[model samples]
Target: MTGPSPETASRPACWRPARADDLPAISAVLTDPAFFDVLGAVTPEALAEACAPDGARRLLAFDIDGSLAAFAYLSGCDGDRPKLEEFAVLTRGRGTGTRALSALLEVLRAEGRASFWLHVVPDNSRALALYRRLGFGREEVLPDFWQTRNGDRVDLLRLHYDFVPAGV
Candidate 1:
């Protein structure tokens, strides 16, 4: 709901709503072969349009040094179930992805969202492990869920994280 607390001040990265100007950087992250292979092709123009305030909600994680490290895009926020359209960390093994995801969840919980879900290519074992570690449960697998730029159809695993209201 609000910015990071004092305790998180020392954290290496912080998450904030992505702005129009961040589209290029976000596109760069999305264009990474590692991310593209898992997700799909995304041009700067397309990313800019998708992340527009009127479209999807985009969050970016910037390092203490003000460098863009990761980003997450959420679609269908107006509905009860928001879907994580894309999530990627430019710098791997630095906990950027985990931190970004944690921040997003905190914001979602504060907003009283019931649940959130994401579709990950089944072959993205690293991402799947991280999602599981973050308490996301594998729901189902959709065959040929995504067709890549190369025309390869990939199966995707749907994962979800349900929020339990406090004092329940």
Candidate 2:
């Protein structure tokens, strides 16, 4: 995808490799009440470890005007089909999340990855809509796929985004 348009230039959001120091902000976004139902529980320590360079996961933080606006967590980074484990945006309806996802896809394309996937709670219509808009297709619905902090099971919808190599 192309870069953000001039209209979004005023509040430019950029994506960068997440650092250990960003753990608190990542945790706050993950555990925010607005996303609690979709994200469940996430601790800062866990986020820090996951974002570590040697870990199986990689995290990209979206910054706007020097503050964390959102984050994307990818697992199985060493493999061909990495999974987007978490994508949370603290500042919603501002297009930050879309920009973050686009930046991530560019990174993955540069790394020669063919596709990636993510699982979302069935009730998260907003996220689902965004994913669809970004060319992600619904793969399947896995019943009782995610367990909440309260021990409740939630159905998950799997979405996949395949990268068609340029000119292919």
Most accurate candidate by TM-score: 2
Please provide, for model 1 over 53-162, each residue's C-alpha lDDT reduced to its tens digit, 9 standing for 90 to 100. Answer: 44554544455445567777777777767898888877789887787788778878887888899999888888998899898984798998788655778888999988
Q: Which ten residues in a row have the lowest lDDT in candidate 1?
A: 56-65
Q: Model 2, 1-168: lDDT tens per residue?
A: 786556665665677778887887787777666666787565566677676654678777888766777888888888877999889887789887787788778878788887889998878898888898888884699998888655679999999988874467
Model 1 TM-score, 2 decimals: 0.79
> How many Å off is the CA of 20 in candidate 1?
3.4
For candidate 2, the clash count comes to 0
